[model samples]
Target: MEADMSAGDLDRRVQFRRVTRMNTALGQEETWADLGSPVWASRRDVSDGEKAAAGGVFSTVSARFQIRSSTFSRGITAKDMLTCDGREWEIVGIKEIGRRDRIEITATARTDR
Candidate 1:
């Protein structure tokens, strides 16, 4: 557990969302839907990197979020996305702290979609 981090440290509110696939007149379309209510979390910048593709360079920013563990948070996975401050992040890693007392999520800024 993060003994030094108190609930007050979780100053930011973030929401989790998952992709929902639906059949359309043309074909299947994927949309995002909220997974649960917003939760308090501490956000911290992790890293910044660049990717090159198709003769272009794209910048990527990664961040880590720490939140108290709960039924809603426990269901979060790499397939889910988190949004805060009007920005969307792609979940990359999840680590349980002290037997699920807390969860640390590593995410990268979404640029592809």
Candidate 2:
């Protein structure tokens, strides 16, 4: 039988569309245009290590890619921040962590996409 898609459902079976991005401070809110592709993962709480990269040297250190819904809200267990159009924004929380509502994502200070 075929299964359908659900919100926040990480289906390892079908390989969900995980969009990884290198978060950072841009001076304002973020947008899909600013977000990188393939979903770069955060190096984690640690300061150094390998993660993921998009449009740069493959050897470049990877950035963080926390969950972000197009709609902004609060309640997500993990704290987040975002940047878009070169502006920085704090992730208050997630109103809905669906791809439809998700948009902005914050990164560590001075980080680049």
Candidate 1, clashing residue pairs?
none
* CA-lDDT, candidates in order: 0.90, 0.32
- TM-score, predicted candidate 1 vs. hidden true structure: 0.89
Q: What is the total number of backbone clashes in candidate 1?
A: 0
Stretches of candidate 2 above 4 Å error?
Answer: 1-78, 97-113
lDDT of 2 at 69: 41
* TM-scores vs. true structure, each candidate: 0.89, 0.21
RMSD of each: 2.1, 14.3
- The residue-level lDDT of candidate 2 at 22 comes to 53
Q: Count the backbone clashes (under 3 Å) in each candidate.
A: 0, 24
- Give stretches of model 1 more than 4 Å off: 1-4, 110-113
